[model samples]
Target: MSLARRSLMEAAAARFGWRRAYGDTTQVDALLTEQTETAYSEAADHAALATAKNTDALHLQPCVLDVRGRVLGDALYLEGLLSGARARGLAPELIERLEHAVDHGHELTVLLADTVRTTTAAHATGH
Candidate 1:
């Protein structure tokens, strides 16, 4: 599920139903997933049989989001968290961005951060 969709569902659950919300969602998700897999299988088979050729296989790629954009986005999210904590007179133990990067380890993090920075720079330079 997408983050936005999950957030909306969570908000709805908080505002409306109290019980079995996730349980209901789980059942629905399972059933829908089963149905979708079956449909895709049938469709793929029919296409291949009709064309008498191998169907083109699509590959899923891993996505690396921009570090700066993600950091700025997290800052915006902290505004929400901090505001909520302040309203309830509580101090939230939020993780700092540097700490998060460090937690991912040195070598892997360098490569990941490089990818984000490279992409952002490329986009900025209109490449």
Candidate 2:
């Protein structure tokens, strides 16, 4: 993962008390998928922010896992950005900023997850 993303994830995790675990990538992936769908759908519907409910399930995912579980932390950060934007009463431009933040977080999570998975696979194969 890029250092910037990693740093952002670490900061977000610390802010939210996410425990880094070694086996949470799958869950994190699931959360990201859900968040991505929600964000896209919400944008498609052009829903007003005040009336919109967040992709609750994605936000509720457990973040207190090992290094493997840190994907959920990234997902949570993205969710927070979305929720924050919505909570701010949805000024059009602010909403756009929130969307960008969430997208960035998702990209970082994917990179981190890929790295974790590759490293784990290499170790398993005794590379």
Top candidate by lDDT: 2
Question: What's the CA RMSD for each of the models?
Answer: 11.8, 20.1
Error in Å for residue 101 of model 2: 1.0
Report clashes for each candidate as comma-separated counts.
Answer: 0, 13
Model 1, 8-127: lDDT tens per residue?
876777788553344587777975786798899899876666456422211101234434445556655555655666677663444344344444444454566676566667666755
Candidates' lDDT values, in order?
0.55, 0.64
Q: Which stretches of candidate 2 lie above 4 Å from their native place?
A: 1-71
lDDT (0-100) at residue 24 of candidate 1?
87
Cα lDDT of candidate 2 equals 0.64
Q: Look at candidate 1 and give me any clashing residue pairs.
A: none
TM-score of each: 0.25, 0.37
